[model samples]
Target: MRQFDRGEIHARLRAVMDRGEPIVMGGAGIGLVAKAAERGGIDILMAYNTGPFRMAGHGSLAGYLAYGDANAMTLELGREILNAVDDTPVVGGIGAADPFRDIGRLIGEMMDLGFSGITNVPTTGLYDGKFRAHIDATKLGYPREIDLIRMCRDRDVFTVAYAFSTDEARAMAEAGADIIGAHVGLTSGGWIGAAATLDIDRACEATQAMLEAARAGRADVLVVAHGGPFEDPESVRSVFERTDVVGYLGASSIERLPVERAVSGVVRDFKALRPRATRTAG
Candidate 1:
C-alpha cells in the first residue's frame, strides 16, 4: 500500500549494507509469500513473469516459452504482490524485448502500479545457441533490456538489472542500473530447478567477474548474486565471501524451493498420521 521513491530505496539498502548484513530481495508471486517475506524483513520483493509459474509448481523456464504474454503476466503478478505487503519495495520485472508494447509506456505503467522499482526478467540473456543468435539478430535481445534500465533511470525509478555475463553486467551498469544482479544460470535445486550446473566455487568466480564488470562501469553500483549455486543460504554465503556482492536476488530459490520443501514435508507428516487404534500408547 506504500510506495517508495528511488532515493528512499537506495537509502534503505545502503543502511542494510552499512549494518553488515546481506540484503535479500525475495521473489513473491502470491500474497501469503509477500506478507510473510515482509514480516521476515526482506529488503525487497520482486514480482515477475516467471514468478507465478514458479509458484504454481511449474518450471520457471515456462515463462520464457510461448505459453502466454510475459509482460502482461508480470503486471498482473505485480498487482497481487504489491497489494500484499504494506511497505516493502517491490521491483516489477519487465520483458523489455516485448514487441507489442511501447517500452516507455510499459515502464510508466509499472511505476503507476505501485512498484518501487523495475528489473529485467523473462530475459533473453537466458537463451543461447541458434535461438540466442536469432533473437540478437532480430533486436529482441539484451540490448533492449539495457535500454529499459536506462529509461527507468531517466524516470528516477530504481533499477535492478540482471546480467548473465560480464559484458552484460557492464552494459547494464553503464545504462544506469542502480543494482546489478549477476545471474549465473537457472537456479539448481528443488523438483523443478535446473540440474546442478556450476559448482559453488566456479559460480563464485563467475559472479565475481560479473560484479566486477558492473563496478567497472559504475563504481558505486550495488551488486548481487542470483541463480545457479546461489540457491541456498550456505551457497550464497560462499558467494559473499568470494565476491564483492552485497546481496542476492532470488526467484525460484525464494518462492518455489522452500515452498516445495515445506508444503510437501507438512503434507507427508499429515499423511503419516495414523488412527488411534493403529497407534501404540506412549
Candidate 2:
C-alpha cells in the first residue's frame, strides 16, 4: 500500500472535521489492538514505542520512565503495525530526544517502513523541577524535538507534535508540525492511568490556549487533544464544546487492557447465573 504524506494527512483530518465529528487517533501498542481500531473507523493510529509497556500491564507514560531501548522497540512495532492494518494511517511515536540517533536517518528509515507520520513521546513535559532544569541545561529535551520536527518537514514527512503548554505548541507549529496536539496528562480511569491532573473544563481551557498559540505560527495547523480528563465520549465532547480542537487521541483508553477490564465484568454477570429452560409446556 502507498504511504500518506503530510498533505494527505492534513486533508483527511479536515474531512473528518467537516463531518462535525472530531477525528479519532487511537494509540495501539500491538497489532491486535490496532486492527480493532481500524474496524472502529478511527482516522489514525498512534503506535508508540511505549506501546509495549501497555502490553506489560503499565501505562504508556511508563515508556518515559525508561523500560528498555525505546527506539529499538518502536522500530520493531512499526513493522508489525504496517503489517496489521491497511489504508488507516499511523503516526510513529518517536522519542526524538535520544541523542544517539541520527535524525535524518531515522526519518528516512521510518518512511521506508511505511509510517504515515511521526510524533514525539516520552516527552520533556514529563520532567519537572530539578530534572526539568537539568534537561534544559543539557539541551536534550524540547530542543531536540524542535530540531527533529524541522528535519521531518525538510524531508516532507508528516508530523504530529505533543505540546503541554502554549509555548511548546508555538515552537512545534513554526517548525512545521502538521498536527499540534495539546497533551493534558494521562487519561483517567484506565487500568494503569496516572491521575487526571485537571477536569474536562480545565483541560479544554488549557487546550484553547495551545490552539491559539499554534495557529499563530501556522494558521491552518490542525489541533488535537490527548490524555487527561478527555477520557470518555462525554468528556471528549465537553472538550470540543469548550475549545476549537479538531480531534482527540487515546492510549490506554483505546486499547485492549482497559476494554478487557470492562469485558471481564460484563461476562462475569452471565457466568454467575444458572441456566434455566425457557420452554414450559409442549
Candidate 3:
C-alpha cells in the first residue's frame, strides 16, 4: 500500500493542473482496473461504493439500495484498489449519512488503509421529494456529508466531494472540500445508467452554476464535472468549452460503458467468425 499525506496529494494534483492539461479521475472497483488506470496516466482513482456494483454488471444505483452497507463495501474495495496502484492517489467514497457508524473513526481507518483522500457517495443529495425531506428531518442528510468533508480537512486529509446543486457545492466548499464535483444527475449512458438526463447544454449550465457557487464560497476551491452528459471525451470537451471545470470525475464513464462496449463488440466479432469450408479439408 502506498500512502500520501494531504499536502503530497494536493501537490501531485496541482502539478497536473499547472501543466495546462485537465486532470483525470477514474473510479476503480478492482485491483486490475486500478492498476490499468494508474498505468494509463489517471491522476486519481476513486474507490466508490457504487464502483463494485457498476463493474459487476449491475446498476450503479445498487449502491443506494439496501443491498449492502455502502461505507463498509467502499472500505473493502478501497483495500483492493490500494494494493493495485503504485502511486496514483486513491480516494475512498464514504456513505457519510449512515446513522449507526462513527464517522470520525471511519475516516481514521480509511487514512490508515493508505487512501490518499476521501469523498461523499451514496449521498443523501441523490434523493429528493418527500423521501429527501424525511432524510433531512431525521438528521441524516447532506449536512452529514458536509461534516465529513470538514472532518477530513481537520485531519489534513484531502477530499473530493460530490455536490448535486449550487447550494450543495457552496456548502461543500465552505466545509473545506478540496475538490467539488458538480454532479448533474446519475450519469446517462451504458446499460444500467439513467435512461434520460440533462443534455450537454443543460449539464454544462448546471455544472457552471455549481462551480460558481463553490468558488463563491471558497475562491480557490477546485471544480470538476461529473455525471449527466459527460460520458466520453468529446462530451466532456463540450463541458470544458462551456464551463470552468478543471477536470472530470468519471464513474460509469470510465469503468462500465467502455467495458460494456469493448466486451460486447469483441464477443460479437468472435461470434461472427465463420467455420472454414469443408473444401479446405478436401
Q: Each prediction's Cα RMSD?
A: 1.9, 3.6, 1.8
What residue runs in model 3 are displaced by over 4 Å at the alpha carbon? 277-282
- Candidate 2 stretches greater than 4 Å from native: 256-258, 266-270, 273-282
lDDT by residue (1-282, candidate 1, tens digit) is 789999999899989999999989988888888998899899999888888888887999999999989999988987788888898999999998888999899988989999999999878999999999999999998889999999899889999999999999999999999999899899999887897689988999999999888889999999999999788988888888888899998878887988999999999999899979869867
Q: For residues 1-282, could you state the per-residue lDDT of candidate 3 as single tens digits?
A: 678887887888799989988989989977888888888899889998898998888989888889999988988998789988888889998898876789999998888888999999888888999999998999899998999999999988999999999999999999999999899989888778898998888889999999999999999999999998899999999999999999999989988998899999999998887778843674
User: What TM-score does structure 3 among the candidates reach?
Assistant: 0.96
**lDDT (10s digit) by residue, model 2, range 1-282:** 447887887788778888888788988888888888899998989877778788767767678775687877888998888789988999887777777888678878888889998888767876778998898898888878888888888888888898888899999999999888898876677556766479777888899999999999889888988878777777888888888888888777788445767678889986787656643535
Query: lDDT for every model?
Result: 0.90, 0.82, 0.90
TM-score, every prediction: 0.97, 0.92, 0.96
Error of 2 at 75 (Å): 0.7
26 in model 1: Cα distance from truth in Å? 1.1
In the predicted model 2, the residue pairs found to clash are none
Error of 3 at 254 (Å): 0.3
User: Looking at candidate 2, what is the lDDT of residue 274?
Assistant: 62
Model 3 local distance difference test score = 0.90
